[model samples]
Target chain A: MSDKLISLLSGIIFGIGLVISGMTNPEKVLSFLSISHSWSAEYKWDYSLIFVMGGAIITAAPFFYFLKNKEVSSLGLKISLPAKQDIDKKLVIGASLFGVGWGLVGFCPGPAISAIAVFDPIVLVFLVSMAVGVLVKQNIIK
Target chain B: MTDFTPYSALVGGIIIGLSVVFYFFTTGRLAGISGIFENAITNSVNRFSNLFFLLGLVVGPLLYYNVIAPKVSIAFNITDSYTLIILGGLLVGFGTRLGGGCTSGHGICGIGRLSTSSIIATVIFVTTGMLTVTILQQFGIYL
Candidate 1:
C-alpha cells in the first residue's frame, strides 16, 4: 500500500491498542504510577501498565533486533532509526519534565492523542497547550 | 483494586507493537507519536503521512466506540481543573520535543531497538513519573 495509507493504518491500530490497554484512562494511569498505593488496603496499584510495556517489548524486540542492520525496509524506503546514542543532560532534564506532566494528569502524547475522540474539553486545552509547548521548545527554548 | 485488566492490556500492547512494526516496515521509520506530531507541524517531508497517521489515530477509537463495542464506556477520570491540564500539556509538549521522543519513541520503539539513549530516557521518565505521583499523593493532591 501507499506510505500514507500504511501510516494511517498503523496509527489506527496503535490508537486501538492504547484504548484497550487502558492507557487512555487517566485514573488507571495514575493508579499505575502510584506504586505506593499497592501497599495500602484501600488502594490497589494497577499492574496493567507494566504488562502493556512488557507485551510490546516482547513482541517488537526480536523484529527490531533482526532489522537493526537493515538499510532498507520492506517498502524499499531507507530505514531511518535514531542516530543519537548519547544519554545527555537534554534527555535527562526533558524526560524528567515530561514525567512530571504525565504524573500530574496521566496524559502522555500517545494517550492524549487517542483520547481526542472522547471530545473532552480538557483534552482540547491540553492539546493546544502541548502544541504551544512544542513551539516554545523549538523556537524560544532553543 | 477493581480496575485491573491485565489480559486486555497485554493484548492491546501487542497490537501497538504490531502497529509499530508495520509502520517501520512501510515507511522505514519509527512510529514515535511525538516525533510524528512534531514533524506534522514543523517539518515538510513526510508531513502528509504524519497527518494521515494522526487522523487515523483519532479515528481508531471512534470506530471502536461507535461500532466495535458500543456498550463499553471509556473511563477517563482526570482533574477538572483547566489550569493543571494546560500546564501538564505544556510540560509534556516541551519535554517530549526537547528530549527527542516520548513513550512510544523512547519507551517502546527505542527500547525494542536496544538504543542506549532511549533506554536511559525511558528509565528517567518512568522513574520520575512514579516519583511525581508518589509525592503528589503524599501531599493529598490526587488527580
Candidate 2:
C-alpha cells in the first residue's frame, strides 16, 4: 500500500474516532471544559475531557517513548526538536487568541474536520473559512 | 443511563496512540495532522506519508464504533453552525500558520517526537482554546 493511501485512511479513522468519542460535539466538549452550563442538568465537573486527553496520551505514549530515543523523520520530513525554550510575546498572544476562539466555538480544526461527516452547512462554512484563513495567512498576508 | 466511562477513553486513546506508533514504525513518520496535510496539498513531500496519515485518521473512529460500544454521540448546537464554523476555521487556519502546526502536530506528533517547538505549539493551542471560551462567555456568545 502507498503511504498517501495509508495517511488518508488514518485520517478517516481519526475522524470516526473523534465522532465516536463525542469530540465532534462542541456542546459536549464545552461542557467538558466548563461544567457550569453543560446540558447535563445534574452535572459536576465533567472528567470526560480528562479521559479523552488521557486517551490520546495513552494511545501514543509507548511509541513516543521509543521514538524519543532515536533520530527519525516525521511525515517524510526530518524532525527538528527545538532547543531554545523561550515563551516570547508572540507565543503568549497567539495562545490567548487561540483559547478565546476555541472557547467561543467549541470546535477545533481536528473535530471540526471530522464533523464533515455530519454534512452540515455550518461545518462546511467553518471548513471553507478555515481554508480561506490558511490561504490568506499563507499567501495574501504574506 | 450510566455515567460516562473514563476508562473507555483510555482504551480508545491507546488504540489511537498505537496507531500513531504503527504509522511511525511502518513509514518512519510522525502522525502530525497539519504537516501531513501541508505536504499532501502542496505536494512538497512523498505522497505516501500524507496518504497513510490521513487514512489512519479516518478509519480510526469506524473501528472503535463497530468494535467498541456505540453509545457515544457528538452533541452540539446546529443552529449557529455557519457562524461558529467560519469563525473556527479562520482562527485555526491563522493559528496553524502562525504557530507552524496544529494540535496534532504539536500535541501528538511533536510531543511524541520530544520537540520543544511542538511543546510550545501545543501550549499555544490549548491556551487558545481556553481563552476562546472565556472571551466568548464574556460577550455572551459562548452559549
Candidate 3:
C-alpha cells in the first residue's frame, strides 16, 4: 500500500476508536473531566476516559519500547520521533491552555475533527475557529 | 455511573493503539493528530498523506455511524453556544501547537513511548482540565 493509503487507514481506525470510546461526545468528555461531580448525587462521573487511555497506553508501550533502538520501521521507512527532552515553558503554558479549553468545551482536535461527520453547525464553527487559532499561532505568535 | 461503557472504551482504546502502531510500522511516523494537522497546513512535506489521514478521521466516524452502527446516533449534548465553542477551539489549537501535541499525541502516543516531556504534558493537561471543570462547576457553568 502507498504511504497515503496507510495514513488514511490509520486515521480511519483512529477515528473509529475515538467514536467507539465515546471521546467524540463533548458531554461524555466533560463528564469525565468533571471529577468533582462524582460525589454529587445528581451526576455520575464517567470513568471511560481512564480506561481508554489505560488500554491504549498498555497496548502501545511494548511496541514503542521494541522500536526504541530501531532506525527504521518494519516497512523500511525511517522512523521519526520527537527528540526534545526538556520540559520548557512553552510546553507547560501551551498544555495548560489546551486543558482549560478542553475542560470548557470538551472538544479536542481529534474528536473535533471526528465530530465533523455529524454535520453540526457548532462543530463547523469550532473547527474554523481552531484553524484560525493555528494560523495565528504559526504566523503571528512566533 | 449511568454513562459508563468500560468494555467498548477498552476495545476502542486498543483499536486506537493498534492504529498508532500500524501508522508507525508503515509510515515510520507517530500518529499524533495535532502534529499531522499542523504540518498538513503549514508544511509541504508529506502534506498529501497528512491530509489523507485527516480525511480518514472524518470518514471513519461517518462510516461507523452510517454503516457499522446505524443505531448509535451521533450526539453532542454539550452547549450549543458558539462563543464558548470558538473560544475552546482557539485555545486547543493554539495550545496544541505551542505545547507540541494534544490528547492523542501527548496522552496516547507520547506516554506510550515513555517520553518525559510527553508525560509532563499529559499530567499538566489532565490536571488543568479537571481543575477547569471544577472551577466552571463552582460558577454553575455546566457545559
Candidate 4:
C-alpha cells in the first residue's frame, strides 16, 4: 500500500502493544524503573519491560538483520537505517538526559504518546513541554 | 490496582516486533518513534507519514481501551510535581534527538540492528535511569 498507510498501521500496532504491555501505565513504568521500590514490592521487579523488549527483539531482530543484508527490502525499496554508530559524547550525554527524564516522569516518547488516549491533563503538559524541548534543540541549542 | 502481566507484555512485544518487520518490509524505514517526531518537526520529506504514524498511536489505544479492554483502565498517576513533569518532558525530547533515538529507536530498533551506538546508548541510558532512581530514593526524594 501507500507509505502513509503502512506507517499508520505500524503506529497502530505499536500503540496497542504499549497498552497491552502496560507500558502506557505510568505506575507500571515507575515500578519497573524504581530500584528501591522493586525491592520492597511483592513481585521483586516488574519485568514486563524485559518481557516486552525481549519479545520485540527476538521477533524483529532476525528479520531486520536479513533485510539489512539486502540492498533493498522485500518491497524493492532501499532500507534506510541510521548510519552513525559511534559512541560519542552526544550519545552518552543525550541518553543520560533522557534517562533522567524517564526516571522522573515514567515516560519515554512512545509511552507518552500512547498515554495521551487516557485523557489526563498532565499528559498534555508533558506533550507540550516535549514539543517545546524539540523546538529549543532545533532553534536555540543548535 | 496494578499487577504483573509478564505474559501479556510478551504477547504485546511480539506484535511490536511484527510491526517493525512490517514497517521494514513495506516502507523500508526504521520504526523509530523519536525519529518520526523529529521528522515532523524538521519538515522532512516524510513528515506527513510521521504524522500518520503518530496519529495511529493515539487511535489504536483509544480503540483498544473502548472496545477490547474496557475493564482495564490502566490508571494514570505521576507523583512528581508539575514542574518535574514539564522539565522531564523537555529533557526527554531534547535528549532523544541529540542522542539519535529514544527507547524505541535506540532500545529496540537500534539494538535489533546491532548498531554499536544504539547498544551503547541503550546501556548508558537504562543504567543512568536506574541510577537516577536509586540515588533519588537514597536521598529521600520522591520524584
Q: Pick the candidate with the highest TM-score.
A: 1
Report the lDDT tens digits of candidate 4 across residue range B49-115. 8999999889889988899888876667775579878988999998888888898998889889888
Docking class of 2: acceptable
User: Model 2, chain B: what is the TM-score?
Assistant: 0.76
TM-score of each: 0.96, 0.77, 0.96, 0.93
- Enumerate residue pairs that collide in model 3: none
Tens-place lDDT per residue, model 2, B85-108, is 667667766666556566566667
What does the lDDT read for residue B36 in candidate 4? 87
Q: What are the DockQ scores of the candidates, in order? A: 0.80, 0.43, 0.78, 0.71
Find the number of clashing residue pairs for candidate 4: 0
User: Candidate 3 lDDT, tens digit per residue, A70-103?
Assistant: 8887668888988875799989999999999898
* Prediction 4 TM-score vs. true: 0.93
DockQ pick, better of 2 and 3: 3
Judge the docking of candidate 4 as incorrect, acceptable, medium or high: medium
Off by over 4 Å in 1: none
**Per-residue lDDT over B1-143 for candidate 3, one digit per residue giving the tens place of the 0 to 100 score:** 23988998999999899999889878889998988988998899999999999999999999899999999977667677777888999989899998999998999999998889999999999889999989988988877
The Cα RMSD across the true interface for model 2 is 3.7
Candidate that beats the other on TM-score, 1 or 3, i.e. the better one:
1
Q: Which 10-residue window in model 2 chain B sums to the lowest lDDT?
A: B1-10
CAPRI-style grade of the A/B interface in model 3: medium
Candidate 2 ranges with C-alpha deviation above 4 Å:
A35-43, A69-91, A140-142, B1-5, B47-81
Of 1 and 4, the candidate ranking higher by lDDT: 1
Q: Which residue runs of candidate 4 sit more than 4 Å off their true CA positions?
A: A37-43, A74-76, A140-142, B139-143
